[model samples]
Target: MKEYHVTVRRSAPEGGEGYLQEYTVPFPDDEIVSVLNVLEYIYRELDPTLAFFDHAACRQAACGKCMVKVDGAVKLACKEPAHETMLLEPYSTRVVRDLLCES
Candidate 1:
């Protein structure tokens, strides 16, 4: 099994402070995984408090609700590939918590 590093920007709800946290997750190197998948893994297996937004339309990037910053580039989380090392951050709008941006 191969492991990857992900640095996530986290923020508290209601105009609280923000910070960056890092995590190590295992993934199949030969297979392609989306950034949302990695976030799900972290939320499910590592930290339940991790917050993010996703909807049914996220499968095709039609909703635009799962938008986040990957290495300083804004993209739909479901459409961005989870790389060996990624820097994940919420949009510059209003961060509700973790990777969630206020709609």
Candidate 2:
């Protein structure tokens, strides 16, 4: 099972509760992948206790809700395959959660 580390910067559910958390996940194959899928896997199997929420739709690289920074450059999470170690962070527009930048 191939795996990678993802650092997510998510906002706290309440006041002054924002921080970065590292998540280790496994990728089966080099199939079409989305940032939200990775996040969902982590939230479902890896750690279900982490408090992070995201909004994603039309995994066809159209909707910008899944836009994030992978190792620095901003790209659509839904467009990029989750196939490597990535530093996922919020965009420059808004701070909703890890790797979720508003535009």
Candidate 3:
């Protein structure tokens, strides 16, 4: 099966040190899947510890709650298409934990 290699910048709570963690998500080579979809799959099937602001988020790009840095460029996770290899990160240094940051 094809897959997408996603590297996420992770951190714990209370000013914890940050690190980079990579996850491989099963994906179709020609399919246009959103980055948020990969994250959901990881959270549901792989790691429950991964964090992001996806709760009650509007997936239509209308709501900017899923904003994050995709390969160094900030984009809406819900709207941005997934790539074969990508890096996911918070939009700013004020990350609460994982991909979530202070709004």
Clash tally for model 2 = 2
Provide the lowest-lDDT 10-residue window in model 1: 10-19
* Clash totals in order: 0, 2, 0
For candidate 2, the per-residue lDDT at 68 reads 71
Residue-wise C-alpha lDDT for candidate 3, range 1-103, written one tens digit per residue = 6798999998855666788998999976676799999999999999999999895548889878789999999999988998889999999887878899899
User: How would you order the candidates by lDDT, starting with the best?
Assistant: 3, 1, 2
- Rank by TM-score (best first): 3, 1, 2
**What is the C-alpha local distance difference test score of each model?**
0.85, 0.68, 0.88
Q: Report the Cα RMSD per candidate.
A: 1.8, 3.0, 1.6
User: What tens digits encode model 1's per-residue C-alpha lDDT throughout 18-97?
Assistant: 77899999987777888888888999999999999868545678887888899999988889888789999987767777
Off by over 4 Å in 1: 12-15
lDDT of 2 by residue, 6-94 (tens): 88776676737677788888777655556667877888898776443355447676655666777788777667777477777666646
Please give the range of 10 consecutive residues that has the lowest summed lDDT in model 2: 49-58
By TM-score, how accurate is candidate 2?
0.72
